[model samples]
Target: MTDKIVESEAPLTLVGGGWADRALLADLRRHAPGIVAADGGAGLVLASGEMPLAVIGDMDSLDDAARARIDPARLHRIAEQESTDFDKALRSVAAPLILGAGFMGARRDHELANFNALVRHPHRRCVLVGMDELVTLAPPDLTIDLHPGTRVSLFPMRALHGWSEGLHWPIDGLDFAPDARVGTSNVATGPVRLRFAAPGMLLILPRDALDPLVRTLLATPGAWPAP
Candidate 1:
């Protein structure tokens, strides 16, 4: 995938957790070389036998050991409490593609809020990674490069109004409400190209499906929102 960290094999990113911090770090290192810790995530970074390029978020959650173990140059703390550590991690990294975990599964509010954050950012090339699936919001007025057999899900954060050129169930002139009218388990039709008149949100899984996804993006130009 274009957004993936390691290109040699299956590109994946592992996000460390506060509980399984040590275990998850090791697991990620074994699988994917690109692993990042957010705030308290440095704990696992040290134990993982690798140094994180950046340790992000406000210093509130970070402890003395986490700070001492990681280098100061790589650390970026956002004193803005209005934003979250997750947002800090997202902003700090320049990775065109991202894979994340432990971002969810902590608290209900944290999980739900993080999911919403993914929608809010709407990075043209990013994945809100998890144990189950990979997620990303589609760029406004653009096509999604996906494999013909790839699966997709369209979840409306606020209210969605758009149509699609290719998908198992192409939505059109439809108003999608949150928690309802959510699109899921859709099979890709050729290269998935979604031309959205208005900005909208969408999720995708790139495993066993990323090949076509990359090819799709190669042919289609990306969309940029009006500032």
Candidate 2:
């Protein structure tokens, strides 16, 4: 069973120790009001003049001053060294949707691990927000309204096959795999719809599409069962 550290009916914002600025945090808060930090992310949250509802991680990156500022009750430490702090925080949050910031930029490996976490925790409905784009693990099925000539990219963490509509090229019979076939730089002709046979497909879209994507994900009936 998953141990939930923070549960919310509304969309929640998750902060990490990566590259997140005040402007980005403020924009994310408009959609996801509640904030939670991952390890040293507590410092970034505090610097924004906002208190995190809970701080979840291995507690190594959290500094003395930031630790002293946060209430002891809100600090959650997971000693396991295998998973990244992004994985820890994503698993601990139980919300309709999660808007993640600070998980991208700075380190290339960390950004890649963020994508790995999205595929690892397929059941978690979360989106990682970057400066120019948004990334999320595509559910079994997803539909979103997009303007003509909008960019839509699909990357597979595991080998999977899927179908698409309103794309410049159809994906009905195409094979997708990380080592071999990957979908990127696809343009949407209009409103786009997609369905995959399994989990592990990551969807990348422009940063401006965050609101619509969140609405579509939440309104979708069911999610892929926890692996």
Candidate 3:
């Protein structure tokens, strides 16, 4: 957005308009280091005394106060009303992995929209970081190291079948659908392995899995299967 293309090849942390506490902001900055705001999220970034690389959105919610604090060079206004601010930011940026915060704790509709945006941009890997949980699209093959008895939830945005290993309850042959069936509250017996039949399967794990999951996503090669 800022004529400034992100030259860094590292993953980026995208801050959204939800409930980003100072602690969460600090943690994201520590790991991803590069921050970008989606419209109203600029206020949160400005409050942290740090400027985002660019603010990409419709520019409807961006107030003058927040705008004044940011350098004009960093403001990017898409002006289209077709998509949510999260979608605008995701499409505008090019990064191998994206860690999003302040996107899950707000209104239910907003949270749902954010998830839809993630699935729409399957080529761009992302993990939605919340206070108590982490949500990410299940890659074709995912191996995660978790202690025994850890909670793992699988929510489907579309109908799909999958197979799993080292789980208290296997996901083999299960038809997962958003409106019909879903996998949730499954426990891990040991390290977990999953193979998805299709994209749109979201893996919800404990918040502690954030860093490890991001690492795994970045290490994986190729884009997700085309929708």
Clashes of each: 2, 0, 0
lDDT of candidate 2 over 107-130, digit per residue (tens): 999999989999999999999999
Cα RMSD, each candidate: 5.7, 1.1, 2.1
Off by over 4 Å in 2: none
Candidate with the larger lDDT of 1 and 3: 3
Q: Which pairs of residues have clashing backbones in candidate 1?
A: 3-97, 145-213
How far does residue 13 in candidate 1 sit from its true spot (Å)?
5.8
> Per-residue lDDT for 1-227 in model 1, tens only?
35322233333353534334455445434444576667776766666677776677777777897788777887777788876677666655544445566675467676666766666565534555444455566666556556577777777777767778778788777678686787767777865666555445666575444434434433545554422
Candidate 3 yields a Cα-based lDDT of: 0.85
Off by over 4 Å in 3: 1-7, 225-227
What lDDT score is found at residue 133 in candidate 3? 90
Query: Candidate 3 lDDT, tens digit per residue, 52-145?
Result: 9999888888899999988988988898888889888887887778889889888889899989988898777888888989988888888888
Stretches of model 1 off by over 4 angstroms after superposition: 1-36, 141-150, 206-220
Give candidate 1's TM-score: 0.72
Query: How many angstroms is residue 192 displaced in model 1 relative to the true structure, after the best TM-score fit?
Result: 2.2
